[model samples]
Target: MAGGGRLLRKAFPEHWSFLLGEIALYSLVLLILTGVWLTFFFAPEMSEVVYQGRYVPLRGIRMSRAFDSTLHISFDVRGGLLVRQMHHWAALVFVAAIGVHMLRIFFTGAFRRPRELNWVIGVTLLVIAMSEGFAGYSLPDDLLSGTGLRIAQGIMLSLPVVGTYVSMFVFGAQFPGEDIVPRLYAMHILLLPGLLIALVTVHLMLVFQLKHTQWRGPGRSNRNVVGKPLFPQFMASSTGLSFMVFGVTALLGGLAQINPVWVYGPYRPDEVSTGSQPDWYVGFLEGALRLVPPWETNVAGHTLMWNVLLPAVVLPGLLFTVLYVYPFAEQRLTGEWGGEQHLCDRPRDRPVRTGLGVAGTVFYAVLLLAGGNDIMAYSFRISLNALTWIFRIALVVAPVVAFLITRWLCRALAEAEQKRLTRGQESGEVRQTVEGGYASDHRPVTRFRPGAPRRPIGPGEHTGTASQEPSAPTRRRR
Candidate 1:
């Protein structure tokens, strides 16, 4: 409690949107706890073994030790399945929360100026988290996971000259090599997690050192922050949030089913379950892979598989590169490098940025949906080839349409706000005017703020020089 000149005295914004990062932090904590529990029972090996434990069906079925250990954890160990499910759910939530948090930051222009490096860190964190998730997903060595790894290997081999060497080095053999699972297990448990923890620690330190950005409103400016201090106010709220996250994950782990590796059985190179899908974070890439036309190039007696490399490699590369360069590009465009920004810009006020964000979101959504095209085609009895073509067309067209519509909507909203400042809001009461014309009364638009004093509207904020409606009485506040 004693925080004289300590981080305990730091203030945080009271906005609900600000809690997104906290959700991510808490989810990561749960992931670490549950993952550690899982590590004890999990065997990261590729050795062939007969599954003799648990249910009778899988007994004597030849499987990898990795898959065998997973079955052991699921059925042999006490509460191991629950812990595994919790770890899986926590990873999903961790990635999801970070994504939504980044969206909030992007839409609010919080990535500008002094916070640019933090934004880059955020992008890096998201990339690493996805990588960690993929590595973990592949460690089970189940049929579904092995299929994903097979696809991964295919993607790797789609590279240029070094593709063959890289693929061999990674798998340590042709395909489904002995060392893949162990290597992934090491990276998942040790390397990626350590990096995640270190990066998270640095992110929090930077957040405190840089101070929080607030909205543009009365008495809130770049020069000052308005919110509760960390010690008793923000700390209490954050602590409550962390507990809530843990409880929800625990409940989901206990109640809902996820990653049923037992039903999937062990890895078989020739077998694949139809309607199988990767986790949501990897769905976009899957969609991209499906949407790209099969195209290859002959280069110096070697083949460049554009069908595989373009969507799998180049798309992701360009996406992350754009994210890393966006803040700097915007700064250069607006000449905002002259001074640091501590106030977040309203999305409507920056139509181009808001539009770009919405467009990108739309693009991702389309790709994500495209990832399940086969499932959708069967569900609706549509032709698979037609559906694939439709998704490919939508992928190109949807983002452009979204950008235009969002830009127009932002401009319209900005204009409406300007109108409200001038003519204010309609009172809805029609009355006879002095010249025998009926008119509705207008009142100054007052924003609602619970538990805070109302901001007095300045006269200069409105000039009803061209208004046709009569002035209405000020409404009493609750």
Candidate 2:
């Protein structure tokens, strides 16, 4: 206990960006709690049942037992609805926080050296959590989820020779089979979550082992980290943040009505709700599918639907593969093969890396926008075809433009910072030069060295050095 207590007293860096990871971790905890509560009431069965619940719209309607049980949980079981909604909302927040945290790590170059494995673990956790959320939502057997599942099956079935077999293996027979809900239930509550929890544990352990990477600021450096101890201050703040996450999730669960399965009704093969959409995390894939033009060719007695296979299967695989290999790729490209980095780089300091990050973000944003093209068209009263064409063009053009612009912007910002360091701020005072020309005074800037003490150690004492004059005079000649 004493040894553990000593370990608990270790220091943690004070940075707002670091909180993004904490948010993701706390949301995962909430998800587990709410999901466990929901599991007690949720039925993972596909037996046909006539709905006999308080939701009048679907009352007496014949639907899968899964839907009926979900309605039961919503209207019959006490506090079940709140817990269910909270679980869903937490899932959304979990993935989103992970994404933001990843961006923070990426831009700061926290994924360098020994910490690269942790990055891999973090990305794996994200993928698992996303899959788990999909499974959880689909267990309700609602129209929207069913549609997503069908689309998934279609994507699988588009995979050349083994497509049919893979689809059958996954569904346990055909589309809307009896075994799928139970299988997804097991995956959602057990398999995928277990994998996520394990990966998260490993990731956290790595973080603890490697300590934390901090920005280049006061009292921060590669050799030493600055901030509060974990035992009291960090622990208290983390606990408070966890509670806040729970409270906010609870609040949103009560107020925000998402995935109202009752309104969408039961899953039917032929009937689909107009403007059907998956959750935001899954939007990119939907957008890709929408963007890809239908192109099919027969070869070797198999119909290869390039559009479906390319966007849905090949694209995601390539994206994740690249993501998995990026740390090494970056290390190789920059020839920065070295030891661990405790101090993070400012995004502007690494223009190419920053530009690449911006380009990827733009690509994702474009696809996400493409996913909602129908809604945009309806909202603005524009032609759907025109909107589709616009997105298709934007999808390719935006990322390239963003890359070039971001690279230039990063370089420009770096130049500005250099100027600020060298020339300092303008004093707004005009002086008559010896050459009879007016010139604005530019004072030299004095910045304290990183890790330098900010306050005096003794009473009635002061610290820091005075600003020095610039190396070269700035007097303009007439």
Candidate 3:
């Protein structure tokens, strides 16, 4: 116990950006707590039953026992609605936090060298988390989830050769088969969450081993880290963050309604609610499907439905492939392949990488916007076809524009920093010499100290020493 307590002495950096990862971890805890509560009441059975619950609209309808039990939990069980909504909101926050955290890692080059495997694991966690959320909601057998399931089925069926067989195996028989709810229940509650926990453990182990990459600053060096100890400072900060996450999620659960499956009625293959959409995490895929032009090809004796194959299959594969290989790719391109990184890069200092990150963000943003095109068109009374065409064009153009602008901006900022170092800051006061020449007063801006000469450090160099004051030059007198 003494030794275990001593483990709490581990150092944790006190940076604001570092907290994003903490938010994701806290949200996962909330998700588990709320999910456990929900599990006590949620029935994943698909047996047919007449809904006699308090929800009037669904009251006389024949629905799956899973959905009926959901209505029961929502309307009849005390605090069930709160727990359910909190679970959903936490899931959203979890995914969003992971995304922002990854962006932080990317821009700061925290994914370099020893940390690359952790980056890969984080990406895997994201993918699993998404799958978990999908499975969790689908267990309720609600209309929206049913629709999503159908779309997923369609996407699966578009795969070459074994599409039909795979879909059949997944559904246990066919579309709307009786076995899917339980299967998804096992996966959502057991398989995926278990994998997530394991991966998170491994990720933290790696983090502990490698330590954190920190911003370049005074008294900090690649060989040493400076921060508060984990036992008191980090523990308190992390506890506060966890409580804040819980409070926000609980407030959202009570005040804001989400995934109102009751409003959408039970699952029906013959019926689908209009303006239906997927969760935000999956929106990009939907957007891709919507934006891809319906094109197919026939080669020899085979048919390729390019429409479904490209956006639904090829795009995601390519995206993940690129993501998995990015660190090595960037290392090779930049020829910075042989070192351990313990300091984070300022985004402006790495112009090409920063630009690439921004370009990817813009591309994703366009896809997310395209996901809501239907709602947008309806809200503004615009033509849907016209809006789709516009998004298609924007998807192609926006990333290129963003990349060029971002690269230029990074270069400009780097140049400005250089000028600031060389010329110093203007005091904005005019001074007149005895010769009647006017000059602006300025203050020297060395990185470490005021009177020291500014010397450029070599790339990836850290000497762990303070700047020396410039020696006074010898003067000649007449």
Candidate 4:
């Protein structure tokens, strides 16, 4: 028991900041646990089957077993709905927590020097996470997910010569197929998850090696992380929080109806809703699609595709590449040698870096909003063309504005700090009388002591003799 306790103590080391990574880990665990349970009942095969389940409304429907099993899980299986929901919610939380944690690392400049590789690993994990979500969501073969897949296919097909071949390979046929679900199932359950676990393991290992970034304060450095040790308090808190997160996710799953396959019906290729949207994480890509003008040209009897390819493949790739490269890019821009700098209480302490981050965020946000152009236009009763144009304009302008605003705010903060340093901090307000164009109640400056040695003015200077004597005496004698 002592050995076990010692091991536990050495492992966790109580810290709240450590909990950020813990949240992600816990979420992933929940996802896997719930996913394993779901896999038992879920039919990965894409064979067509008639739905004759307890849900009276959707009985006698012809659909793929994958979809049918999903429906069964939704309406028939005991607590299946809750399990499914928990799985989904956990996935969302997992992705979201990782993103926030990465951002925390970024703004604090923790990704500098020795930790740069870990930053790359983190970005790769994010890509895998999103891919996992995409593949998992598509497993049910529902309308919404199918629509998303179509967009994905469109993106895939937008590639140059190999586009059609890639799409065919991915889908296993033209559009809906018997093999696609199984392939995606393989990816969702096996490939992506394996990659995720590996990446996460590396990420954690790197974190432990690098140590946690500390909060900015006097004498505090990256090496000195502030928090309770892992033994009893951190472990207990982490365990309790994990259970709490699991419970909340379960509760939401039970109460909230998400991705109702019945409502979406089956995947239909020809039909598409006016405002079909994917989950929030992938919304930025969709926004880019909405904003880009639909243009096409043919050269040498092959289509030169810009509209589909750019938003789907090129843009997303660029975004991910930029994210992965940002730490290095920043290092290059600053020209400052890297060192451990954990605490960053003020964003303005790194003004240029902060501005860049904000600008990138603004750019992402603009693209995200642009993804829902149809919804926005329909809701506002505006022309789709106008909406697209507006987004395109905002895509260019918003980042500039965000950069300027962030820079200005940083400068203002620096100015405030400078003022604080130059003028003594006011404890309480005191009225000052205007006399000799100076404040009457100001404190007087004290002169140097009589025996204090004066600074040497030049070579052969004396301390307190002729050279140090007041010049006013000589002037008066003359």
Q: Quantify all predictions' global Cα lDDT against the true fold.
A: 0.87, 0.83, 0.85, 0.76
> Against the true structure, candidate 2 has what lDDT?
0.83
lDDT of model 4 at position 360: 88
Clashing pairs in 2: none
Alpha carbon RMSD to native, model 3: 6.6
Model 3, runs deviating above 4 Å: 1-6, 299-302, 433-438, 447-478
* Candidate 2 local Cα displacement, residue 329, angstroms: 0.8
Clashes of 4: 9
Candidate 2 lDDT trough over 10 residues, lowest sum:
469-478
**Model 4, range 60-100, lDDT digits (tens) per residue?**
87778888999888888898888998898898899999988
Q: Candidate 1 on 120-207: residue-level lDDT in tens?
A: 8999999999999999999989999999999999999998999999999999998978999999999999999999999999998888
Q: In candidate 4, residue 478 scores what lDDT?
A: 7
**Candidate 1 residue 279 C-alpha distance from true site, Å:** 0.5
The 10-residue segment of model 4 with minimum total lDDT is 469-478
lDDT (tens digit, per residue) of candidate 2 on 167-236: 9999999787899999999888888988988888888888877878866643345776556677688888
On the 0 to 100 scale, the lDDT of residue 177 in model 3 is: 95
TM-scores, each model vs. reference: 0.93, 0.93, 0.92, 0.86
Error (Å) of candidate 4 at residue 144 is 1.4
RMSD (CA, Å), each prediction: 5.9, 7.4, 6.6, 11.6
Q: Model 2 residue 89 lDDT?
A: 95
